[model samples]
Target: MKVKLMTALCFLLINSGMLNAQVKDQKMGELIDQQFKFADQQYKVLAKNLPADVMPKTYNATTDKVVTSNTAWWCSGFFPGSLFYIYEYTQDAEILAEAKRRLTILEKEKNNKGTHDLGFMMYCSFGNAYRLLHDPAYKDIIEASAASLSTRYHPAAKVIQSWNSSDRWVGPVIIDNMMNLELLSWVSDHDGDKKYKEIAVNHANSTIKNHYRPDYSAYHVLDYNMETGEVLKKVNWQGYADESAWSRGQAWGLYGFTMMYRFTKDKQYLDQAIHIANFMLNDPNMPADMIPYWDYDAPEIPNTYRDASAGAIMASALLELAQYSNKAESKKYLDASEKAIRTLASDTYRSKLGENGGFLLKHGVGFLGQNSEVDVPLTYGDYYFLEALHRYKEWYL
Candidate 1:
């Protein structure tokens, strides 16, 4: 009788463990499936609505109309990342082919010297494209972009310069440039170039010193004297004036510093990332979804729209932070991130089969001032949302 009772208890324990593992696996599978479904649906809609003959470099969606502008650099990365996600999930050759073609088109315009958004436009999209596809031509394109980006590095200021033509921003370094340093690090690794790594580290350190406000919220741009390496000013180009924190800028700092910590394992970068993330998570104005509007200081109240892309970016970074830090405090941030992702996957932000360009989440503001694609579908929003979902599955579920 005693032997039989012990055997039954062991059996129950084994069965419970198996059941728990199975449940977790099922949850992850469901999340990945949802992300793939969202991506697949968006791809179909974009392919159908956006004509092939339409110039890829000139498309911009605004509230009034979809205008053709010569400088649509940032959107370039968003579409490729979206398509890449679809290809990753399905392994469909057609998806890969289309992404490759789009990347090829982007390759041509990489050296245009028009904007300061090279990382968003080129590296994140084209560099990631090359990394996944393993195509030599794409690699060449990224290498060239890395070179161009390296030229923007102001050695005296120990940071990358923004706005090439005029002194209007002659010594200015923006938080957005933090997103660009990944390319430098990648180039340093790929081509055995020490200068690339040095430049990237210098730029990251400079931003760490100059850009962050006392509250951990950061300025959009900082003017540094190129000759003296002195910070002349910290200005807000995108946020409300008087040094308000732009929600997206904060996200950029969180994401960028997290990346820097990943590469260097520097505690300062990790600390900075955690500081900004804490501010964002604790802010009263942030919605339940953990996504904020373009500016935290925007006058609009409950009606203020949220930036889904910000949440997406921060979610990805938070997952990285969770892995990087093994403390109770880190767990708090991770829990908050999981909650945010759960909110994003819930009905509030999620889209139906035939709404808002079939994107997974809605109410993403692309350009607030222009009212362009305000509270509408954004490609990066979709990409990062799917990415966070993928990471969630890989880690917890």
Candidate 2:
């Protein structure tokens, strides 16, 4: 009789778990559907207001105007990238049409070597274009853009120069540059050129060596001397202070290293990504909702702005990292990502339909130290939020 009781209890527990799984799946499906529907509407309004010659950058709620940037802007690809993501979910012809239109203007950047954002400027735009359309034309553009990005790599420094020499620093390599390595990795896979992959690997290695604190949190910028391959300075140009942890910088590192693991299957990269993920998640200053402040160590923590962009990027990266983690670690990463996604989808972060200048998410901090684009809807924030949703749907759902 006791054996039968044990068997019955086991059966009940299994059924309960299965039922909970079904409920969770149902909720996630509904969330993705609802968000995508609203995203489609928001982007349509954005499309109407966007000028034909430039890309959407941010919206000034106070000014009630959509800001624009030229093709060379680091964030130029995000608008088109967001459109492609919406199209992927909604299959909206209008979104696809708008994306193609922007692609025409952005294709000119394939020859632009002056910036290290070609991956963001070209890959996020053309990469999705090719992934969705499988067009030879987009492939050609990606190849050219990869070549252009290659020109920025300094062999001695073993890293890509993020920005040209400024009066303050020369050969500055920012953590954001890590996000651009995807373009190089993609090119190597298709073009049969190992050189692009080598550059990406070298860059990742150099970043691992110089850009990180001992705790695995990354710095915003590391200026190196190109000739001597020496790191001249570790600075926080965009964060609260020189040693403070910039929230978006950490997100970029997490996403970039996770992506590097995807391309190279390097266990070291995966380990680094996991460490960064843990450092960000375990930090005492991280908000309960998983939406971090603009800087992790920002002085006015409770008073500071929450960076939705950082949250979105971290959510997307964590979801991918979950795939490569052990069972316990995977659950931890997935749970954090789910919490972040739910928070960002809430009214506080997700913009209302026809509001927020057609952007999906809100309260992104871009260069808060410089007093620019603070607490506004950023194109990249929307892009990564959509990406996190897509990853959840694709990988978890």
> What's the TM-score of every candidate structure?
0.85, 0.93
RMSD, one per candidate, in order: 11.6, 10.2
Show the colliding residue pairs in model 1.
none
Taking the tens digit of each residue's C-alpha lDDT, what string does model 1 give over 1-397?
3453355335433443343333333455675677586667656656555545332322233342222223245566766767777787778787777777666667765675555567777876777677677877877777777777787777888988876536577577778889888877887888747788888899899888888879999999888788889887778877766478788788889989998887788899889888988898888887654667668888864445567678878887788778777688678777777766765665455666655544566656665666555565566677777777767767766
RMSD in Å for candidate 2, one decimal? Answer: 10.2
Task: Put down candidate 2 lDDT per residue, 216-318, tens digits, no spaces.
Answer: 9888989999987999999899999998999999999999999999999999999999999999999999987788988999887665677889999999999
Error of 1 at 375 (Å): 1.8
Q: Which stretches of candidate 2 lie over 4 Å from their true place?
A: 1-26
lDDT of 1 at 359: 53
> In model 1, which range of ten residues has the least summed lDDT?
53-62
10 residues in a row with least lDDT, candidate 2: 15-24
